[model samples]
Target: MRVTLSLFLAAGLAAIAQPTLAETLSFTLDNQTPNMIVQFHATPADGGTRTELLKKKGLYGGQSRKLTIADGSDACVYKIRAVFEDDSFYDVRDEIDFCENDTYTLAD
Candidate 1:
C-alpha cells in the first residue's frame, strides 16, 4: 500500500508540473497596396491595450505574412490598424472578428 501511494503521489506531482498551453491567435496578412507597411497594431475591441504585430520588420507591397498574437487576453475581436512607410494609416474596419477570419488583406 505504501508503494502504491508513492506512485500515485509521483503521478500527481508530474501532472501538476506540466505547463499549461498558451493561447494564441493566428492569421495571414496580405499587403496589396503599393506602399510598405511599417507599423501594425492589433487592439482589442473592448478598449483595452493594443498589440504591435510587426516584429521589427516591414511588410512590403504585395507581400504576405503570417501574424500571431498572444497577448494573454481573451479577446476574439480586434481593431486593426496598419501604418505605411509614407505615414499613411490603414484601418481595416471598426472592429473585426479576428478569431473567425483567417486572412486580412490591405488594398488600395
Candidate 2:
C-alpha cells in the first residue's frame, strides 16, 4: 500500500509541474477608413520566414479587432503591421519576447 501511494503522489506532482498553454496574442486597430485592407505579421530571429496570418477590410467605423498568433511556432520576437487600401500603412514592429506559455493582451 505504501509503494502504491508513493507512485500516485509522484504522478500528481509531475502533472502539476507542467506549464499551462498560453493564450493567443491580440491587437486592435480602430478608426480605419472604410474599404481599407489590414495586414499583420509574426517576426522571428534568423531574419527569415515571416508569416501573414490575417488580411481583411475595414468592417466598421471606429471598431476594434483582435489579431491571432498561432501556437507551436519558432521562438523569437513578434510584431504586426497594417496597410490601407489607398497605399497608406502603419506598423508595430517591436521585438516582443514570447515564451511557450506566455500571452499578450492589448486594450483599446
TM-score of each candidate structure, all chains considered together: 0.76, 0.44
Q: Model 1, range 1-108, lDDT digits (tens) per residue?
A: 999999999999999998766459999999999999998999888877788999769999999999988887778899989998888897876688878998988889
Candidate 2 whole-model C-alpha lDDT, 0 to 1:
0.54
**Ten residues in sequence with the least summed lDDT for candidate 1:** 18-27
lDDT of 1: 0.88
User: In model 2, what is the error at residue 29, expressed in angstroms?
Assistant: 4.7
| Candidate 2: segments with Cα more than 4 A from true spot | 1-24, 27-37, 57-61, 71-76, 97-108
Q: Each model's C-alpha lDDT?
A: 0.88, 0.54
Clash number by candidate, in order: 0, 0
